[model samples]
Target: MYLLMMLSAAVVSYTATWGARYVGNRMELFSPIRSRDMHSTPVSRLGGLGIFAGFAVALLIASQSFFVKDIFRNNDAPWGILAGAAVIVAVGVADDLLDLRWWIKLIGQSAAALVVAVWGVRMTIIPFIPEPYVIDSDAVSIALTAGLIVTTMNAFNFIDGLDGLAAGVAIIGGTAFFLTAYWVHRTAILLDRSDLATLLTAVLVGACIGFLPHNWFPAKIFMGDSGAMLIGLIMASAGIVSTGQITSGLYDRANGIPTIIPILLPFAVLFLPLLDLGLAVVRRTALGRSPWSADRGHLHHKLLDIGYSHRSAVILMYLWTCVLAFGGLALAVFQWQVVMAVNLAAMTVMAGVTAWPYLRHKAPGLGPRSSAEEE
Candidate 1:
């Protein structure tokens, strides 16, 4: 299933690249709003439309394929997801063409989230839980989901600051989600329901794969608002869907953590984007500015400031993403011994380099104490 899905996604992504180029060269929906030493002249910014097409088709095929027909036929999840996705895409398309106000975009995102909530698909906390873990608020659930949707969409959007940056990160995250979802599907099959989680995983992988060629280093086209918005929506949707699959009607205490693993799956998968958003907010707040205020303080911006090429910054971030991804995967699978061993090894290497005496001495007064003093 993974093989077929990847193959189809590659084809779709390659084709989408061409489609994006055609639209950029011909339609003139939107052009590069910002550029910083990008390789291509007047870089294409709305390439996301092509990625969305491939993503949609790829997911539909992966889910409704002959082997998984029953899963598709049984539930309204797919259709409901599609409706919500359509809303996000439209909102993004408008933003791409015309600079929509942030508030307008927020409203659109909330409306889309409300669409899902109305499908009897709202997130409900585990009722009757003891203190600390007890979060019992329907309004809070709604707000969290809406905010999460908006934040995820913008997290992907805002991180599109360097060439191939957002696309590469999306692939990393999609791959992580795919692995975790597949794990959930396997556990689900052992329990009862056939593994639709894997099908969703396959679709996500295919979508990212298809988009990467056009979006990789020296990108000929960009996965503009269309692609980023769609990517965020599906990823958010996949997280929700997998959570439902994993925690349905099976609450054995031992299996609970493993089952609820997908809840944290999306956050870990897209941690770079999420982290970027957080840092952006903090930086802005520290400067007594609005969170939406733009600046060159992003991690990518910092990498560029430090003399790394755009591609290098993107690749370096990708490496960290993979490390966190696989490490988190190990944790999810209950391999604490392996995870701990790997964690220790990582800290050792980090200590060797980051704590190197010579480097630290060269940049005087830049040790733990300085950092602590700053804090």
Candidate 2:
């Protein structure tokens, strides 16, 4: 049933993207080429509309499914998620067309997150503490939830510079999250505890997969802020829902590693984007610029600067994301020692790949001239 729902979303999103492309062209809603932009041509940034269409339709279908109808009947999280998605998409579309100020976009993102947090998707406990620390204050819970969603939205938005980068990363992270949630459901003592998380991740992954073809290199359309933030909002919501109601007992029985894996997995899965966000903020602030200032100093841009092709740069980041995400996920189901060993090996390989350009340049008669020499 979940598979069917995912497929339905993919089909709807794929179809909707064509429509969005048509509307964008007709309306002249193309994103302007900036100094930091890779593409010289203006591309429609309305792909987010298509993603939302697919995501919304998928959830609607899930709500009707006999296998998962209980998610709607017993919980308000799904409704909150849907409402938040709608809010972000509208804000994103506006930003894509009008180039709204950063603060304005932040306000919109916060409002969207609040809708979900208030609707019962807020975090209830800190997952890594020896004993789960229950959040007793509603205000604090809502703030934390909103902050996470906003940060995630911005992180994704930060990394959306490359064609299909955001969507591909979302698919990787979402799939890992889905698997983790499903594992939690299987081992969970309580029934349906992780169902919402599982369902959300499934649909999120499907939406990205459906949108990827059009958004790939030599892109037909861009997801713009709307699609990127939408992906972040949903991914964060899934993480929150997965851990919101979970007890320490679930972790105790699930693995030999510490119970921290449940909460830590989301951070690990999104490590690359969050890392990019952190570095960008620090780099900009040190230079007396607004953290929201745009520049070509992003990780993807650095990749290109260092001689990686557009597709290669995007794929390498995807590889890095998978290594972190799945490596962290392995701790949940596999022995800590084995997971650590595998992760270390994967990271070593990735590091070599990431530094390949420099390595080849430094090697004697190995490859073409470096990007520096070419420039």
Candidate 3:
């Protein structure tokens, strides 16, 4: 059933992207090439609209399915998610077209987060404490949820520099999330628990997969801020809705995984972008610049500088995201010691590849220097 829905969303999104590209070109809505831009040719930045269409339509179809009838009949959270997605996409489209100021974009993100919070998708539990505690203050819950949503949106936007980077990461991260949520739903004893989170993640992954062809390196159209933030918002909301609603006792601990897996998993899936976002802010602020200031100092830029091709850099990042995200998921279903061993091995390989340029440079007569090395 889930597979069918995912495929449907994928097909719709793939078709919609063609239409979006055509409209964007006809209307002269190409993304402006900047000094830091990876692409030289003008490309439409309207791919987000295609993604939104796919996601929204998928949910509407799911709403009518008997299999997930309870999810729709009982929970308002899905509607909130849809509404929030629309809000962010609108903000993203405006920014794509008009180049809105950072504060203005922030405001749009907050509004979208608030919409989801109001519909009961806000964070309710504080994880990582020895004894997980429920958040009793409504204000605090809303604030935390909004902060997470906004942070993720920006984190994803920060990493959208490379073609297919954001969407590929989204597909990988969203799949891990969906698996985690599905595992929870299957294991939980509670009959009233909703699978809304699982459904959302599946649809989100499908949309990204569908859009990837158009957004790949030497792309036809960019998802821009709209698609990137929409992906972030949906990913964050799935985590909040699934993990936040469950208590620590409900987490499956038979596999020797910590109870904090529910909360930790989301952060792990998003680790790369969030890490990138954090580093960018610190780098900019220390230089007496606005944290939102654009530069060629991003991780992808560093990869290009280090002699990685555009495709290879993006794929390497995808590998990093998978290693972290699925590695985190492994803890929930496998023994911690085993998962840790596997993760260590994976990270070692990733680090080696990432540092290959420097390693080759230090070893004379290894090979001819690449263009980046010569520069």
Candidate 4:
């Protein structure tokens, strides 16, 4: 059943990738990225629907499966997640077409988060508590859950500036969840718990892979608001479901990590996007600017400024993400200290790569700068 759903998801996603172009053509909605005003030709802005469509179809199919049964059977499982997702998709589609106010989009995102929160998924961690299981059923927990959900949703949306960047990152993050779910499923004796998270993550993976070819460098279609929001909400909620809601089913010791360490798994997988958003917010607020102010100051912008071609910059970022996701997995299996040592070495190497452009700018043999260089 899982295999069938995965296959169905891939097929549906591929068809949607092709169908998106036809839909955009029929709707006569095409425009290049805003950065590329130089190109007057209109390109499709509705490519997001392709991804959304594929994801929706795959999710619907999974809903009927035994794996998805937890979500369908649980009180907050099926309806709340689905309803929240619908809100995100609808709001994003409207924003893409009509350019909705940023606050309005936030409201939609919040609505979805609330649905997931109030119904099924919420952080039960008590403030200043040590034991993992002790929780106060109070207002603080609800507030924390809402705050976390909203922040994560926006985080995913903010780092989606590059062509294939967000799609790839989201897919990678979802793949991490799928892997964790599978890993836990194998070691633990639970069947239903793995089914829901695994199926959802697999569906997300299939959808992203199907769209990646078109969304890759020199993108044929831009995912825009609809796609970004859809991906963000799912990635965020998937984390909520997988770690906060489900990991407790596993009977493992603390294993030296924090009681809430499992929650960090998704964050590690999505370190790139979340880091980009967090840094952008800090930078903007420091300059007394709204966080939403559009600027070419993202990590991608920095990569470009330092002379990495767009494709190279993107590939390097992907490699970094792999290091974070798999490296952390290694930590979970091997030792945290060893993983840290390897991570430090890899980071040093990456830093050298990043500085190569600066080194190349240095004068050769202390001679006068070339006329072209001076110019």
Model 3: residue 162 alpha-carbon error in angstroms: 0.9
Question: lDDT values of the candidates?
Answer: 0.66, 0.89, 0.88, 0.69
**Candidate 4: deviation at residue 199, Å?**
2.3
Candidate with better TM-score, 3 vs 4:
3
Per-prediction TM-score to the true structure, in the order listed: 0.82, 0.95, 0.95, 0.87
What are the clashing pairs of model 1? 13-210, 48-224, 48-227
Counting clashing residue pairs in each candidate, in order, gives 3, 0, 0, 2
lDDT minimum window of 10 residues, candidate 1:
126-135
Predicted candidate 1 versus true structure: per-residue lDDT over 114-142, tens digit per residue: 77655524445433222113236878766
**Stretches of model 3 off by over 4 angstroms after superposition:** 190-194, 369-375
Residue-wise C-alpha lDDT for candidate 3, range 91-149, written one tens digit per residue: 99999999999899899999998998887488988775566678999999999999999
The alpha-carbon lDDT assigned to residue 133 of candidate 1 equals 33
Pairs of colliding residues, candidate 2: none
Ordered list by lDDT, greatest first: 2, 3, 4, 1
lDDT of 1: 0.66
Query: Candidate 1, residue 208: CA error in Å?
Result: 1.7
Tens-digit lDDT track for model 4 on 1-375?
555666677777778878887787788776434672212456566666777777778777766766554556645465566676677777877776677777887788778777767774666653222555534674666566667777876776776766788788777767766776667666775554445666767777777788888878677776777777777767666666555543364525324453444666777877887888889999999999988776778887887787778788877777787777776555545556777799888878877877777577674654447799899
Residue 365, model 4, lDDT:
51
Model 1 TM-score?
Answer: 0.82
